[model samples]
Target: VYKGLDIVTAKVTKEEQAQAVHHMIDINDPLKEYTVVDFRNKALSIMDSMIKSKKTPIIVGGTNYYIESLIWQTLVDNPKRAGGDDEDSGLDESLIKVRRIDGSSNEELHKKLMQVDPDMALRVHPNNRRKVIRSLEIFEQHGVTHSEILRQQRLAAGCSLGGPLRYDNSIIFWLTCEKEVLDKRIDARVDSMMDKGLVQELLDFHELYNKDRLKKNEEADYTKGIFQSIGFKEFHNYLILSKEERDDEKGEKLLQQSIEELKRATRKYARRQHKWVRNRLVRRADRQVPPLYSLDSTDVGQWESEVYGKAVDIVSAYLDGRAPSQPALNSVITDTRIADNSTETSQYCEVCQRIFIGAQWNEHLQGAKHMKAVRRRRRQEEANEYREAVEIEGKDERAASVEAEA
Candidate 1:
């Protein structure tokens, strides 16, 4: 989304973009954050204009939340309280400003949220400071829990989790590749970026944006804007080195390490995308989801038949108001009873010294790490018991011996 993050994002080349119109690309400053709300509003306007001109707006993106914002009525709008009351109407701006200035941690914000809206707290991870603050803001603004607002929306939409689809006649095309194949492709993609002078690109960007910060001994922040890009942060150590140092053995090693880190991060990101598809889109039975068609793209040689051709045919049939020849992937049956209870209420695991929410707690109980921890604790307890028994027995024997001696 940032302008200067061209190489790392693998953004479409100017020549390719010239071939077809694209929206929401190169629209934000690398220094400033571009939010999902901003993207949704702009994309919706673009889609409206396209639809008015009798054109289909094809939404393509890896960011699932951005796509969700376009497809579902998910964004909550904060309205003013009745009677134009200013006092106690919304989150206190002064307090929030103070917190910002003080640099309040995510845990602090989450604790505050837990006090007011435990349900929302449960849904949002404590480490996700942005969401915790947002939920608090919603509650203070509307005089209702953020979770309650969503619950009402879902109730109105007659869905278990989210509101109804913004566009009823929507179709989803999910291109999938085998995990092993996808990992290889991700590694290859990183190598290709390297060949295209990715290092030089990072060097230029750092010189322009990050040199001053490093000189001032400020740590490179990878949580914000373009800095969050996988390749950018992985090269932080190498990027900070003096030109001569960067040319030395240490620099070469650091560069290699960064490259490998980039590859690993990219692969991990791919796995997360797959997990999101499976959990949020495929297996999710709590909401009204659009018909999804899966296309196997494991073999590039068969791309014409398996992916591109199938996608073209599916869209064509949908445009013609005819059922596609291929069967739509089935959604798991909606179990509303279970869905209602799946609010991810916070559950802490003492054995692991970590918190697991809702389904995660159940999964944690079944996980090997948790089991290992449990066994370790059990053995420790047994050892303590045996030691205590032996100590008591020794004390008794010593007393008996003393009496005999006496």
Candidate 2:
């Protein structure tokens, strides 16, 4: 969401953007952090204006959290008014500051969250510093735990954690691709970016913004703005090289390594996007979701007929209040073993030294790594027990020998 990071982001060129209007493109300063909440608010305002003009505002993006904020009543605007109790219902004049606590590590922030809202802490991993901090901010700003706010919302709406849908007349279209095809497409895209002077773009950006910070021995903050973009951090080593060094053989190898890393990261990110669609939109049995139509985009050759054509027909049918010929995709069957209240809470495995949230715990228990850890621990315990037994036997014999000698 910043200027000058266009190549890595694969931002549409001015020519491409001119073909159609786009919102929220390069609207924020690169130095400043632009959050999901910020995106949601601005996008919502644009959507409202479009609705007034009788325009169908089609929300298109890969960022699920930002899309979730727009679709569901997830964010707690004001806790006082949210619960509708006799408690302070007045607007909080103070801003809801969702930032890290100064001088506190991620674990420390998570501990503070555990103290205030154990339920939320259970849901969020400590390593996810941003989310842990956000949960803490909720409690600090509203004088109510983040979990409590979600509970109140659930009670009020008689629905799931994020409450009901913001718009009743809404539909979701999930465009899916085959895994092998997607991997190839991602690699090709990365190659295209490199051909489009991605290295030079990073070099210019680093020279402009990051050179001074590096010279001062300050760590690169990848948590903010355009720095968080996949290509930037992946190319850090190559970007830091001097012009003469960058021309050397070692620098060429490093540059290739960076490109490979970028490709891998992009592929990994694509997998996460697919997982989000499956977990959040498709198989979430606990919450009410809009009808989702899956469009197979695996074969780019048939994009018009399989994807675009199907999407247009589905949208038209929905707008006309008629059922489309193509039926909505069914939710994937949830695992009965993991589909329990217990799974909603966090489960920590001492053997693995890892915390698993919700269904993750069940999955982890069944995983090879966890089982291996358990077996290793069991063997260690057995060895210790056998050693203790031998020592006891030796001690008894020594005592009897001493008695005889006396």
Candidate 2, residues 248-317, lDDT tens digits: the string is: 9989999999999999999999999988777676766666688888999999899999999999998888
lDDT of 1 by residue, 1-406 (tens): 6786688889988998898998888877775555566677778888989999998898997678889999999877645322222233342564344335335677888888889898888877787766777787777666788889888887877765577888998889998899999989998999999999899999898887766666677556667657766788899999989999999999999999999999999999888888777666666656677888889999999999999999999889988889889987744334332345445577889989897767788999999999999999999999999999999999999999999999
Candidate 1: the clashing residue pairs are none
What is the Å distance of residue 337 in model 1 from its true position? 13
Worst 10 residues of 1 by lDDT: 80-89
Weakest lDDT window of 10 consecutive positions for candidate 2:
82-91
Flag regions of model 2 displaced more than 4 Å: 78-100, 211-219, 240-250, 330-343, 386-406
Candidate 1 at residue 194, lDDT? 92
